[model samples]
Target: MPSQATTAPRVALVTGTSSGIGAAVVEHFCKLGHQVLAVDFNPAGKAVAGKAGAVFYEADLSDPDACRGAVTEAVKRFGSVDILVNNAGIQHVASIETFPEEKWHQIIDLMLTAPFLLTQAAWPHMRKKGWGRIVNVASIHAQVASPGKAAYTSAKHGMIGLTKTAALEGGEQGITANAVCPAYVKTPLVDNQIADQAKLNNMDEQDVVEKIMLKQAAIKRLIEPEEVAQLIAYLASDAAGAVTGSSFNIDLGWTAH
Candidate 1:
């Protein structure tokens, strides 16, 4: 990265900031002097974001109105929303044949549509300023597929399309949109997956980590949340001004194959 520029600190709205990649992002941006509005449905996120020096807004992204309202709060409280990070997500791991239709809707609503609505809400402010950044925290599943992650893979793939479309529309306005695709990370979500996969596959937790989780990656370890956060901070910075409409992977070589 280039020497940090002396740009004015931005007003940022970040979703999913209660834990995992979201929490890490809140910490990183606060450390960089940006005023962050951390939004999460989890009330626990309130204290987490507060500790990171960010204002907290508890809103469930799955509700379309909540997405818009979160952005509204950011602009209402702070002057403008210079950056939006859509990182809230959940997962279910049943085979498509047995996948719950409700689970599909829930995942899609939160991961794909909410980002679009939040972007819609934030677009005008960004247009007014002639500068903005939108980063979607997608997954390696955006590029590749696996058994029993139908809804997850679908939402991630849709995210790339949403990001590219936003980039095309925002290109001339100095607003860049992109997605960061990370593989399995050491997050509470992944911890749940470890336990779930063990039960689903009739394997021990260690066996699931080695055989199911790390089997496809050349680097056989879970990614740290901070690793993903670092990449996101760079993408949101002026340093990546020309990098948009693309998916940057920190997938432990999972997609290299």
Candidate 2:
């Protein structure tokens, strides 16, 4: 295999940079001296990007055009996009019968289709440069199932398929694709889910965390955003040039059983 040819301070385009894992990834890459284009639909992402010394692009990633445009904007700003992190996602919990069709589309589009579009847009640049890293932030749900997460599970599972395909096609060109499947992380998203779960189950938030979210894990704690970010940083680095088409689980032993 060809050695990773991308030079130092490569440009990275990360989606969903407004908060949680996305914000942490932007901060990590920026701290590593890489030029980062932080894309998020949230206006507050501007502050995050600014504080991290990254350029911010506000766009709804669910929009197909916005996905492609983000790649263009990154290249226009930084000359080339050497790393792409598809991390934008939203969760809607509902039974299959009660899940809204529009909500399903929203989740699939943002979490699944957006990554494909962004990857398609970034492929040529990476092919030309002979090096690229594409990290798809999947979930433990990608490999497992939850009762009310029909759409989320489907999208994450599809993300792994996308990762494998990209890895196979990009392997010879020095572009590696991988997925990071993290269990519940300490983020606003999970916090909101905990509140909702507590109300639904008539239990305290702490109980929901201990009995519901971490039930399968031997280690009973939520993973931190920075912890996940460290793994993502490793997969995105040239040191992981040969690690492709695999899903690394940071599931706090959730899948051990």
Candidate 3:
């Protein structure tokens, strides 16, 4: 009844679009004839969105007001945020006792609280339209944990909880919420982690990824950003209408063990 997913153009608000999976999502959605509002804290995101033919909004989502403002900007520019992708995040590696209090709070605020605020801000718009899709980009750590990643793991785990809650609340209103938990992806974010991982493991940077990051992965390789983007697109499409309250793992069999 709703027609195929690509028949109509939906407005999408995607965060962390300066590079990596965020940029890939922007490009993919735009190619599907959707209007996209690309939000990122990095000023360079303006250029990335321009290249992708998406409107760009720069905001530090850790700020509660900024999180709400991002959704407001999307509605202001594209009429409504028909699709919301909570994909902006960062990683900090340290033992629980050694992790800085400020960093932990920042990570939780940005990765966990921001998504909640954004969802709250977008809920009314979606309810009014009787249709919406929410995709949270969680990680393999959401379901499992590793040492020296206290804040990152905690926030990702929280994200899956938020996704489930949103799915439950949105079900009767024609909105669906889901999370994609991917293993290490070939993105700048993961690349940035290599140094910290190497330092934490006392290993060479190259060996850190091969011997550590992908060691448990049956595929023995990092996922590409575009690959994760494809899964997010599918979850956001009308074809996935029945798929809600689910956490799909793109972990290359790492979780299969």
Candidate 4:
């Protein structure tokens, strides 16, 4: 549990809150007494949000208008958004030579473009309040890459770039922006990827897990969603105001090499 002062009640808007890291983040914030706005296309998001005492909004983040609308609704319901977590993303694996053009566009739009628009929409509100926290959930792939993940890797890299630039711009206003880069997390996303990789490479799911996913981690273990959520909760708090324009890694030493 986070300290009460560190989790002081604030209005937080977290995208991709339906499950995994995003859902954990929402729950953490609510436990810290923050008013949360949970956004996701998943129908179950509303129930999850309700349980966390957060207001829920269902929308496809790939749509720029929907991203903007979510921000608008948050402002209307909460008066202001003190924190924003850009966590919605998707993965499509294929070699560069054979990657589908449509998949490339969709991945980039959802992971990179949506964050840009949401940040743009929320900027003025944060500026008015003179305090804000924006944490982008990037991946270790933001700095390192593996085969068959060009679209996912590129979008993660772009997210880091966006985080840095936004941090620089928001610093003068007491608003902070940062990115958290983590390795394979034990989430539905990774579970789905394991199955997808098994089918794609004609290997057993266990082989995919051992031979591919954990091959590079020093710990050789998947990270828990709550672990990443704890870091996010810290960054979203008033205590992290000084920690901006940076990429913090929770990759179990994957990038140390």
RMSD vs true structure, all candidates: 1.4, 3.0, 2.2, 1.4
* Candidate 4 error regions (>4 Å): 1-7, 200-202
lDDT of 2 by residue, 38-145 (tens): 999999999999999999999999999999999999999999999999999998876788889999999999999999999999999999999999999999999999
TM-score (C-alpha) between model 3 and the true structure: 0.97
Residue range 82-164, candidate 1, lDDT tens digits: 99999999999888888999999999999999999999999999999999999999999999987888999999999999999
Looking at candidate 2, the ten consecutive residues that score lowest on lDDT are 1-10
Candidate 1 stretches with Cα past 4 Å from truth are 1-7
Candidate 3 per-residue lDDT, tens place, 1-257, comes to 12234526899999989999999999988988899999999999999999989999999999999998999999998899899999999988888878999999999999999999999999999999999999999999999999899999999999999999999999999999999999999998888988888888888998988888898899988999988888888888978889999999999899888
Scored by lDDT, model 3 comes in at: 0.91
Whole-model lDDT for model 4 versus the true structure? Answer: 0.90
Cα deviation at 113, candidate 1, in Å, is 0.7
Q: What TM-score goes with each of the models? A: 0.96, 0.95, 0.97, 0.96
- Cα lDDT for residue 154, candidate 4: 94
lDDT of each: 0.91, 0.92, 0.91, 0.90
